[model samples]
Target: MLILGAFNLFVGRLYLIPSESMEPTLNGCAGCDGDRIFVNKLAYLGDSSPHPGDVVVFRGPDSWNGSYTSQRSRNDVIRGIQNAASVVGIIAPDENTLVKRVVATGGQTVQCRAGDPGIMVNGKKVDDEFTEKPMSNPVDPATGSQACQGPYFGPVTVPQDNLWVMGDNRTNSLDSRGHMGDELQGTVPVENVVGRVEAIVLPFGRTGFVDNPDIQHN
Candidate 1:
């Protein structure tokens, strides 16, 4: 038990999906039982960094706080227990941690327009087959693709050592796209990443390795 706890603390940990932003890829629902996943803590320990299409868990930037609410208990006793349990992967930490897929890495320009087939990164169209279909907004007649829903955005360059991320459920996700006006241009600092998602561990029916395709190549 002690060894397992230490492993969770330094090597890997488990996290429960909190919302529907990553649907169709990762199952989650507000105030409901969601998929539990394993996050590999050592994925970017040295010279390695997050890459496009890698789903990661990170602490949202300060500018994102207004859009999220913590789920921690108000009771001091229960909250303390939850915090302690989190240290051993027994429960997820009560923090503003979020899960999203990397769309553009540092120094890459990413954007989507009304008539585009998909998001373009460094001028190449990204393969976004993993995104949920039939987006929440009306489809654009120009391209017939739900890539940007209604509004178009970006061509924004990601800062060095940062990442531009979005959810698989594009239309419902309030990811980097919704924070374009903030500092870092809504890109998340690489250092803020907690870990890379390795696999879904709970809810046996959905158990499997999460795909981390090289989106820019396609």
Candidate 2:
């Protein structure tokens, strides 16, 4: 029985939010900085629903890659220890594990235009109450970034079976709009999501249940 219990412990796991991809909720790095969030590794057991604005944790496809890839986080030593499985993409992330806002799921279109003031879902602006900023940054395909400079894109439709994701820090975030939803580059599949991020469990100032509750997808 102890062996079964131990096996269950490793089969399921917990993680802390360590980045700003999810903000104003889950405190993925409070103040846009810090590590704190705990996930129920088995939360997807039933027919669960992943709503828009819910901070979600997922294992990106073997092909879905990050531009700023690192096997370890410079901010924490535990990050190095916990991520010891870097070589195999297991314990250390090997570039997997992403914390992002569920902007649109299944069949929906998400649009954000500079000077437009908000994100539009199916032509209607999504309630931007919980977001730290509007989703209106442009991506440069050549450089695979929006921070270098903008003047990018518009009217992007999130395809079926894929979930459109983004970071709350619009200007500095690399999300769905990064490369025309760059295949193997951007855009997360529904199958990739494991569970919704529910709270910050470390750094006393940023611990509690996540709060981005106004998200409504069309």
lDDT of 2 by residue, 58-84 (tens): 776555564547655675776766554
Runs off by more than 4 Å, candidate 2: 1-12, 26-33, 66-95, 133-152, 212-214
RMSD of each: 2.3, 6.6
Candidate No. with top lDDT = 1
TM-score of 2: 0.68
lDDT (Cα atoms) of all candidates against the true structure: 0.87, 0.61
Give a tens-digit lDDT track for model 1, residues 1-218: 68878898789889999789998899899777799999999999889999898999999899988867767799999989887787777777767899999999998998887666678898889888898876655655664445565357887999999999999988778899889999889999999999999999999989999999998886
TM-scores of the models, in the given order?
0.91, 0.68
Candidate 1 TM-score, true structure as reference? 0.91
